[model samples]
Target: MAVEAPFWFTSLAGLGAVYLSVVFLRLLPYLVLYLRQPKDLRRCYGSWAVITGPTTGLGRSMAMELARLGFNLVLLDLHPDNLREVSDTIREAHSVQTKTVVFDLSLVGTEKGDEAMRRLREAVEGVDVGMLVNNAAVAKPGALYFHEADVERLVTMIRVNAMALTEVTAAVLPGMVKRGRGAIVNVGSGSTVAVPSFPLYTVYSSSKRYVEQLSSSLYVEYKSKGIDVQLQVPFYVHTNMLSSAVKERMLLPAFVATADDYTRAAVRWIGHGPIAVPVAGQQLQWFLAAVVPEFAHNWYRLRKHLQHRAILWNLN
Candidate 1:
């Protein structure tokens, strides 16, 4: 026996689905706040800049660049040894004041997390923190087959990527707002521009998208108050985080942007404008992905898979 649905009921359900879809689509781009705008956080040059994930990769690069620009730094990382090494390097090379706080950002928001932030604030008391870079992130390779991967890894990713960022921003924003000047730069990925075929990256990408969106909304809300929020979306660079295959795929003409190249561009654009895309050429890819028809985009992604057997292949 075939059970037929009532016409009115089916129509209403379909309409609801369509409405939800439209709302999500409208909110998607701004969802990740993945672009960083320029703002003069250096209003107090030689002042303090707080950087998370500062021991390596893009975060380390940003720290060094800021040091060169005459900003003292408070560097945070999970690895104490690496943090000490980086702190020593910056202090010696740049001859600037530096502080190293070694703690796992992923651990900071639990019952013990609140105490940690309090301690951090107390330690940096009276030091004007003018810039905050939320750049620490971790990714477990391959597709997101939930059952296959350790759930704890995903939990940590969310904690560091989303929870820690929110907590740190909340901790420092009041000071910036009170002073009527400050810059918050959140590092994100170009992958948020489109859904990747890689399974496990879904959680990581979603978390980044959350950061981007939060940054955008915060910018809108705080710009008049003199708080500058910038979200940076960059393609893959040479970082220890990626596997060799991933590195090779990222270096393709379309997808590659070196850490130094992107960081220099980002710093130059800081305090100069509202948002900055370090690699302007990469912006074209984002535009294409956003504007192209869904069918065509899917076809493009499929073609890349066929052309190269790589799990993640750049369009270039």
Candidate 2:
């Protein structure tokens, strides 16, 4: 005979099952629609994709993947030579048209921003831009206290991480709406949810939190308009951005995932509703952050922070 649990134990078990059911129901649709046909995606979204910060790391990786999927691109970044190189590489490799826009998104409200936005707008006037990847952002070097950080760099971080994404969306969204279909992927950090709190990376974390909210709200406002806006929260991509911080050689399975693998997953998940933690490990990390106690998450985050700091400083 099956043994019955005590009254409180049975009640707790029932509640746990209900919680799990709720979580699964929320995840069911994304699991089913993880990927649609590439051709169908192209037809729905369009042939052109605009990627900011396309000169290096995750941004460059995403640009290449999009080109392989048969999308023309408008690539933007502060690095002119790198931008040109990326554009030429895409053109040579994919037989796809490419436009390189050397725009400094850090100057979002200045004269430079006005000129850059004007040029960017003119550059993509007749092009069918179906995707916008707001992938450019800046972070503080090392884990420093907020008071110890440079004020100028902090301001630039806000401009690049927050304002620039917003302005670029303003520049591109109307055309997508007019075309009646498009996809916008806002790149966000896993620190927003994967960790209980970010200490030294305060500004970057807050900026990503902004992107998370912006992407979700835009998804709600535009989904019925045939536009898909997804915030991709990914963790520990082994890119230049990450490589600079640690002494050890960054490797996949050791340092989360490689840039190529991460970007490929992120690009294919463009229309996966408001947020997409594309990697199974990252999804699980996010889930743990949500379900676990805040104190537990904080302890883990703090422990990892010290380990990273030690490695970065060669103190280990």
Candidate 3:
């Protein structure tokens, strides 16, 4: 005769079984999705790429990598110094033709911003831009609550992250459509998926969410037209965008992909098709966030908030 287990032990064992079953059930769809790599992104060498926020982080790294891959570059940024450095580096290192446009994308529609884009358009008027990277972004820290947040900054964030990307896409799209080929790579954040409780970056994340959604809708609209619009979702990267304290806390155990890593993966996959998640592990995280139960997802978000706080405190 078999010995009967204690009630508490039996209950714990049953709970563990249920948890494991839920995890496996959630993972099955991702496993299938991950195994099937889309075929269109394999050949992207020699394409012309226009990269916004091209002076630092993922944007800068992408400009360099694309140049190395034999693509001509149109680099846009607010800082002329950094833009010059990046252009010179790419020109010397890869011998690829490079153009630098210095303009505050957040200020678009203003006399200065409009002039900048107009000048950029004139500079590259006839040149075919095979890819447009909408990667520039900004955030104001410490104001975690809505009431405390800077309205001006929020407006600026929307202008740059949402409006500018839209305008730049519009500026380049007619030519791309007329030519019947091109790609638009919009850089989005994982925060949009996790929906961080940090109110300071609320506007920033919201804008990114808009980009991701718009990119997807545009992809569907233009698929038959031969224009691939890709949404590149990335998690926390070691960039100037985050505070030092936040960076220390947000850095994951998994490879904190450098801008170069992101750029390479992004450019390669952009050619494959629309909607590429550059980081592998984080892609799973995104998938789970998308399909998971709302309550469960909110619980996970709460845990993330706590984790972010803990990381910030530890840094201090």
Highest-scoring model, lDDT: 2
TM-score of each: 0.78, 0.88, 0.80
What tens digits encode model 3's per-residue C-alpha lDDT throughout 1-316? 9999999999999998987687676555446554776433314312577889988788888877777777889888888998899999999999989888887898898999889889778756888777788888776543245675568878988999899998888887877788788888888888775543333456878888899899989999988888888888887677777666766655664747676766666665664556667666666566556656777756766666556556545655
Number of backbone collisions per candidate: 17, 0, 5
Compare candidates 2 and 3 on lDDT and give the better one: 2
Better of 1 and 2 by lDDT: 2
What does the lDDT come to for candidate 2? 0.83
Candidate 2 lDDT, tens digit per residue, 153-227? 888898999999999999999999999999999999988867769876788888899999999899999999999
**Model 3 poorest 10 in a row by lDDT:** 38-47
**Which sequence of candidate numbers ranks them by TM-score, best first?**
2, 3, 1
Give the Å shift of residue 118 in candidate 3.
0.6
lDDT of 1 by residue, 1-316 (tens): 9999999999999998986686566444333333644434466422899999988878899999999888899988878899899999999989999987766787876767776787668656777888888889887544435675578888888898899999888887888877777888888777665534323456777888888788889889988887778887776676765666655653475567777877877775554434556665565556546656777755665564344334533422
State the local distance difference test value for candidate 3.
0.75
What ranges in model 3 sit over 4 Å off? 1-46, 194-200, 288-293, 299-316
Q: How many Å off is the CA of 106 in candidate 3?
A: 1.4
